[model samples]
Target: MSSSASDVAPRRPLLAGRGLLWEAVILAVGVGLFFLFPYDLGFLSRILIMIVFVLSLDLVLGYAGVATLGQAAMYGTGAYAAGLIAIHVTASPLLGLAAGAVAGAGIAFVSGLVLMRAHGLTLLMLSIAVAQVLQEVANKARPLTGGADGLRGIRMDPILGLWEFDFIGRAGYWYVLTVLILVLLFLKVVVNSPLGLSARGIQESPERMRAIGTPVYWRLVWIYTIAGGIAGVAGALAAQVTALVSLEVFNFDHSAEALIMLVLGGAGRLYGAVVGVAIFMLVEHVAAAVDPFNWLFLIGALVLAVVFFVPAGLLGLPKALTGLVRR
Candidate 1:
């Protein structure tokens, strides 16, 4: 069951015409929505942040074939790092984000050293353990983390000394949108790079990749670290926008829901993350508004429908339908 590079890598270069067209479409849609929902910036920002978070997951569980339920480890660490820095030292959002990224990458590198060695159930369990440990530490360190009550007083300075974080969130919306675009563009490059190709090859078969002189172990760690940094950025964005960090950021539900979003969108296709998050969040928002207590039922039904009807995920429906047509 060997998969070729052509099979795993994107068909077209990221800078190709088609790729640029896709990027343009995303930009247009984002800007259009910005105008359409002038008042729901908070919600929009949440979706965008989740898009980034899930995008990071795609790089690991999707591209690298590393399936684990502990991504919240990096995410929670990033949020706390950003919040702590904002409270104790600097209020510069950019600085806080950098601190968050560094903290996430730091944790990922250390943990990946060991977790990447384990596979199957072992890997999954170890990943969960890593996150649980961090969560417990955060919970106990009440003096610094504010414990279960959550970390507060995360005031942020204006963006680059120009835009103020207005009460209505107009400035915050644009800030998040800009960062999201940058993340998408950066991942586009990563997905097309030599490292990216090696990661995919490793995913198909680590033993084969190792025989071919591909540093399989290091590749996994590298990609996982990169994913951690991105996840951290997402957490930082959440902390900065809300001006608070909470224990729930590390909840197992966060990682589980993110994995579900990846499944619904179609893993490995980077843009699929965006499509999945947008659809899932919109459904949840509407469902919760209509029936707060029963929203989970709607969400569960939607998940079941997607799983049974679109096994390849909603993003793959077009190609799946085309195959059936030809048959």
Candidate 2:
């Protein structure tokens, strides 16, 4: 039994290697898009930003097995933090990103202390409440957050103080793409690491993990905090590239959309986040253009199809098809 278990464990490392290879291929495709669709850079950049946000969600909900619908809480917190720093402190893009990351992690850490204690629907409700409270606070702090009008006048310095942000968005595209790749690479390492494996173990059988002396609660808090920082990086990128921060960043829709994207691609698998965002956004763009009134109906249909058929997500489609053929 021990030998069999050890043999099975090695397969995980092999899968990890394959996952990294897939990420590289995805990165190549993303780079090719810049030259292939220069006119759609703005829309593509938004997808890249969403990729980061969805990836962060994958970390908590997918890997840690924490069901949440309030990731926007951290996302909006990061956006506002970075935007305010840029407007009041300095225009350095890096600094703003750092501020956003720190602010996001801080909020997650504080909230996780309480929120992590709950489970099932209770946990989900508390998460939503945190986001709602933050939203209300932002709405009331008219002087600081810009309230309903949105936060504006954000000026970001050039990348490394060299590459200027042109009107065409080429710089922003490359910048966001680079950041996404780095984050992806970092997370790839993370999910394959011992820490990541432990998270997965906890997800599969928390009682067993606890029985083995794992500090499940603290681990969850750590991952949640890290995931929040990643989400913050996404929000900061949006603030800098677009030069505007809005309350909509904290909206429940943002979280819902992210969850959909993650499910569409296949959660717990890092590559799913990127692929899901790309597919969903492309469908949304084309569907909305085709029928402005009922684009969501198309999206809903797609989601239902995925849930019923390719339940593992788009990433698992090939295997799903293979199994079907074998049967």
Candidate 3:
């Protein structure tokens, strides 16, 4: 191997050595904490769903180098699709979930084409516009989506024909957790695949990748669509848990929150998304409990601290500490 290749190869093992271990640790802690808390399982379920949502953002924003603020559009689409399908078509949770994924992928495929053309602030603005349009559509399509009233009467069958979701939300918590793990594993595979490498290459420099004969635009389109599908799954999860979908599904705050989670945990790392959600939700809960209005102040300060001190994100801090310790 070339000297540079040899140098790079050694570094690969260090990155690999603890990623899985760290994931296991986090997952175990999440499960343990869920059981330990006297809190409602429904709340835990929401956090789990958010993890999937954040991870979806990580795929596009972190891996594919797509900076978008319109993720909620796809999320809301999947949610509504799942909710509508359950209410109007089939109550089977599986089928409703599929519908949501299809809806998300369909929208992403179309939007990615238009979004791929722009970059930087222009791209961000277009994404926001797309989300806003969807939110407006959801509002105007009152009869179908229930308008401001929201979609209700969604009844889902017991998951996998075994576990029934109840008001206590035990089944929902476990169900969402299982789904999150599966999605994370699937994403890990995708990111480590050839396609993911190309995405990284595209992110670093589309011009260079194109010169090397990579079909940059198409790659982006596919990646964006896949990310959308995942986000759709997250929406489906949320819809199933809440059994309600509304114009709020398309809310820009949803996208903004997901972005914050992605950044808080650290972009480029999948598990960072999960950690970000955990911390964000924890802080949110604590803050709201202490003072509803002042919670924002605490969160704002926390975010600023992370940005200034841990720019790589919370996930990066552990590695940084470990490196320092070793040195």
Which candidate comes out best when scored by lDDT? Answer: 2
Query: Tens-digit lDDT track for model 2 on 1-327?
Result: 676666543344434555567768877998999999999999999999999999999999889899998999999999999999999999999899899899889889999998889999999999998999999999999999999999999988898999888888999999999999988888988898888998899789989999999999999999999999999999999999899999898999999999999999999999899889999999999999999999999899998999999999999999999999999
* Candidate ordering by TM-score (highest first): 2, 1, 3
Q: Candidate 1, residues 27-68: lDDT per residue as tens digits?
A: 888889889999898999999999999999999988898998
lDDT of 1 at 8: 67
Q: Give the worst 10-residue stretch by lDDT in candidate 1.
A: 1-10
Name the lDDT of candidate 2.
0.92
The residue ranges of model 2 lying beyond 4 angstroms of the native Cα positions read 1-19
Q: How close is candidate 2 to the true structure, as a TM-score?
A: 0.94
Error of 2 at 326 (Å): 1.1
**Candidate 3 per-residue C-alpha lDDT over 256-277 given as tens digits, one digit per residue, 9 for 90 to 100:** 9999988999999888898899
Off by over 4 Å in 1: 1-14
TM-scores for every candidate against the unseen true structure: 0.93, 0.94, 0.92
Residue 186 Cα positional deviation in candidate 2, in Å, after optimal superposition: 0.8
Better of 1 and 2 by lDDT: 2
